[model samples]
Target: MRKLILAIAAALPSAAVAGGYIVPNTNPRDLSMAGSAMAAQDSAGAAYANPAALSKLEGLNVTGGVSLIDFRSTWTDSARIADGQAVTMIPKGAFPFVLFAGYGLKLANGMKLGVGGGVNIPGGGYSFWPGNWPGRYQIVTVDRKVYGMYLTSGLQIMPQVRVGGGLVYYRTTEHLIQGINFLGYDSSAELGTSGGAVSFDLSTEVQPLKTIPLTIGVDYKHQAVQHLSGHGHFDNPPPALQGYGVVDQPATHVLTYPNRLEVGASYQVIPQLLVTAQWTWERFHVYKSDVFNGGLGFSLAVNRDYKNGYTLRLGGEFQALPQLKVRGGILRDISPVRPETLDPTLPEANVWAGALGVGYEVMPGLQVDAAYFHAFYDTITAAGADQAFPGTYDTRANIWSLAVSWKTDLLQRRK
Candidate 1:
């Protein structure tokens, strides 16, 4: 009975972590370049991509955008009796949306600063699976939402070096449902929670050579630890299990968002061509376990054993016309989830992605950007990972984005 309760508590965190919660880039131009915009800091997105690059701007800048994400996934039980039938799952509404907005300014004193905010699906993928699916015992439905706000500042301390930092605040809400089997009878468990955390990031940009149009950028984001308190409800427990911590009660848990490091370089190979390459690393190993505390002195812990993950990105932009820019890029993202810790709720695998985008100057100080991105995930087959659940998992995703940016030289106007 205690074991079953622990399993219910454990499933909640896995569901949140395994839902592709991390968004690579929210800006349309950055996404179009496969997230390789760290060093090419010409857009307002530099506020989030590399705050140090904000120093490069000479005016007031604002950018707003939205991304529509379409995610699809399937799971197949490994049991012989189940044959090869697959269960499909998808988010429960119209295509999910990620939003971004940024504001930047270059002060009269030559100092630069920016404030950016956005809505990210970090843990908020409203995925729904059939109640009778083979993996129902693990997870049935999950609804989560996370929001972030960024305040940043940048300074060019030297002729060739710029440094910056930012503070981040995140708020999250989660609700999950999973099926339970008590002997032959069927039951269900539900958990709801909400919490917030604060974190920070630092960045630096450097120009090494006097005659070269090359810039190197490095950025680091600290980890955030969230403590959530909420309620847990269980239904249809057997008569014997009614009094044994099986009742509805208050619950609490802690979840840690990983820290990250990104290093990138951008160079202008020609007057009309710019290229960028970046490498990103995330410390996912912090997600070692889930500890849950419930009413009636019920406490349990479950191991996750996640590892660190990394990504490689390559991108380029070509000035095709005086008023138009063309962009394309590719990326390879490696997952941190291992076979030993694989769960139906966290079916993640390595992926390769490609993107294309275009920016058109609508007016002297206004531009419109649009992009399309697609990700191909490697199918995963996990056997003997769990006696109750073993299966194959496949996933696919696509993103479409649009944005408008406006910039004006405030100092120039004063002069």
Candidate 2:
């Protein structure tokens, strides 16, 4: 029983890392531009991407969107224990949604202010591997979900400068299953937990020169730590181990989401064309380890040793006609997961992605946007890592987005 408990505890840390991969911007308009719209304050998604941009809006602006994602990966175990066995893992399609509404008003004192609130999915995913696969001991299945709700306010302090801040609430849920080998008997362990946390973000936008037609935007998100508590259930244990401490029990864990910073600049070269370039940095180094506590009087800490990561994006939008627009962009994303700690549950790697999209104005004050994005992940081979699963990993993903947006000043001016 003690050996079984130790083995299960040792494996839990790897499973805990499953859902940490960050999801891109959920707004289809922003997504179509390869998520490079931080300084392009023409849409309501600014509530989440860069709240300060909200001040640039004239009156009432709203956007609602959905993103459908397909994630695929494969792992090949080269270690002697597995004898070069390969397996494929595919998560069911994920559909994450977003909704944001913002209102800009002129106060009696001649000050401009914008207020907004909404919800979005920032990160989370699901993956399943065959129970009998060579790496089943590491993980079999992982399902995770994360949701973010925020209330933001932006102030146009000066004709050329705007600033904003917001309070955000994050909630997450996870369920994990992994195989356990005990005394020549095959068993399984499952852990399920849900938790919530609160954090904040700040943003600033500057139009350095009125003649330059250039805008620079910066946004920062604070880190958040969530405490999760749930039950750990052991199944199919041998009869001889029935009397041991292999029964179901409560469990607890802690997860620290990383702090993020993004800076971007957009320039309007002509009345019909606009281009943007953005850079994002995440403090993933804080994710050094994961600690798990089982109510049965034992605890385990596993090392992750993740490094900081970044992404570079460039995109452009063209006003083809009075009622039509076309967009395209490219991005390079550097992963935070180290080779020594890479696992199949979430086989994250450096990625290169491209996106194409279009927007149509159905009528006055109403528009629809759609986009398609594809990611090509670089292959990774890890060997001689102390805590890593030695293997070769390959992964890729596809995302499709659709959205609708509306804007109007009549509602706010009626008063």
Candidate 3:
């Protein structure tokens, strides 16, 4: 019995985002416009969003930026209280951030090349309470982090058509701790895992009508499966479980990060005014592995049964002045988690988000950008049916970002 339980604990957690995870727009300038830069990428973000748009960029351009995300939530379970106290848990707000940098070069005859990479802390939060808390057995502390890097390129097929794509590498790390009753003795378990994988992306853009100021773009990113291996440790084990001890297993489980597809269009309403809309589809249904079989007869599995999800975004940009531009947009995303699986590890929910931002030309070849975003989510509730946790989860988040990019013709002049 002890061996079976320990083997189950060896499996790590999984990641699927319908809200507050897998942020598509990493550029501060684009985030300001609610990630509407798909068809109107005027900055160095082309390398990440739609590499096909690179042809629209000129000369040598370098961009750098960062985004700060703040997470807040409260979990309540009246039936699980132990000491006749308030049945509530408020997670300490977490400040996770993303960093980005990219460079693009325009070659002769409408050809473009770009290389870029960044770090994304898509989803992961920490929760803590006294060891005697009623929900202690469910969870205590969970720290999960995911990040990725990529390189891309683009070319103009015709005067109004372009195509692009790139390759990516991703990594995820997780740590979880929970309390258990062992022969009437208080005991705790710690589990850890870390692994990396490779993926790729493809994109294209076209102007269907030259007489109109309209541009359409689309992109696809392949899914990644992280194969991780780690260990489990027990503290203060009771005599019955003393034989289990500390077990160190290496590289055993696998987690799937869903694939994604996005399509966007931009229309210039007037000379200086532009409007854009985008739709994104996440193939969460393809995520089937709930258990990871680490080699050496060690394996773990959990049931997620996630469903596919989508996001809709709309934004507009105005060239208020020759040197300044203003932008705003809104988004609605559906959650992928099925109700029975809602737990502290991933308290996900449907969300509505809005953003406001602006860009300014510090000089002829230098641009600075800034934007702010807020997300509101629906409360999640479960009655403990089907053996799932019984409780309510309320959550929300905020983000702030800033960036700078420089475009120069020095390379062209040197030639």
Candidate 4:
């Protein structure tokens, strides 16, 4: 009841806010160490990370953040090039959005219930530089958008424990584009796809220690199956050389859906300070299909889908004043990618981060928040993809971000 609305402390800048190589495969935020799910309370932002935290909110709230990812992925092997020519430079971009809204109501018995939803960017791929877009292949663009929502109810089942659970729904759209050769002619082909899924979350918050001002919460979230496919189209067809062929743009690639699991926790050192952590698991090997083609309108090929991976996050905050805060966090992204599935498009790695922010109350029921953060990643290989590709190439990336949050009371005055 003493926490004031924060604006700068919760928002992120452009670079760290979007999906990129080192930042995160998904949306980045200014919340804390654990960028995805935070230890925040009262604000509508908690719903995206843990629905059970929604009951703690006292009013109707809305929050949204954007993460802009900047990176470079290049092809270094002259042998991989079609005509014995190698690529030295590459440029790419990914802008991801994370939206959130929440509302809470108190019952006659004093228990709380809440609901919230949003559009999230799980990941993206856009590695198009100068020479041949790297690897033994190229991708003009790889964009994806995902949406989901949840309704949760928390009951003070006992004096020290609160139990809660909720159902979730997801929707998505993904677009893919790649260019090879027009066979001496000038032609292009691009593809687009759409898919969705459903999931659930179960959580509990408990006050285990009485002497220390503290509370702990644990949450689990799972996503259902999501199927995806993209259709391709040809523009202008080029000519052929030596009968082998020259393509301005070849076919496209298609993939199926996968599942995900997430677990997180939050701890408060005092009314104005707290720390948090989270782990996420995603299964891509469940992906099945064959051939990454381009000759026709699409590309298909057999692949050794990678195993699941984990993202570990940790962050905390310090309130210099009632309305100001300084924060920082770090994440280790150990991908389960195999040497065979490696492509220049999605080269996984580990990332580190730092952030600062401020929040304010301009008037009753009205508030504004802002935040800043920086993320760093170590180089990794995008090898094993494209039968034409030979070895894993070297690469690295950096993400910087800034964000804002605004909220007002609709039904009641909550945090």
Top TM-score model:
2
Residue-level error in angstroms, candidate 2, position 174: 0.8
Q: What is the per-residue lDDT of model 1 for residues 312-374, given as tens digits with 9 covering 90 to 100?
A: 999999999999999999999888877767767676788899999999999998999999988
Alpha-carbon TM-score of each model against the true structure:
0.90, 0.94, 0.88, 0.75
For model 3, the stretches where C-alpha displacement exceeds 4 angstroms are: 1-21, 78-133, 245-251, 294-296
- Best-fitting candidate, scored by lDDT: 2
Write down the TM-score for model 2.
Answer: 0.94
In the range 1-415, model 3's lDDT, one tens digit per residue, is: 3343344353334222234246546477777777766888864567777778766666667777776666555667644644333343443444444554555566666556655555555444444544566666766666666666667777776778888888877787777777766656777877787888999989999999999989999989889988876766666566655556333344356777778888999999999999999998888886554675543455556666778888899999899999999999998988777767766556668888899999899999999888888878788775446644566677777778888888886766787
Cα deviation in Å at residue 408, candidate 4? Answer: 5.2
Give residue 16's lDDT in candidate 2 (0 to 100). 20
Q: Which residues of candidate 4, in runs, are more than 4 Å off?
A: 1-31, 36-40, 78-93, 131-137, 149-159, 182-187, 238-258, 288-299, 353-365, 382-387, 391-410, 413-415
List model 2 lDDT by residue over 157-251, tens digit each.
88889999899888878778889888678899888878889999999999999889999999999988989888778887777877887878787
- The predictions' CA RMSDs to the true structure, in order, are 2.8, 2.3, 3.1, 9.8
Using TM-score as the yardstick, the better of models 3 and 4 is: 3
- Pairs in steric clash, model 2: none
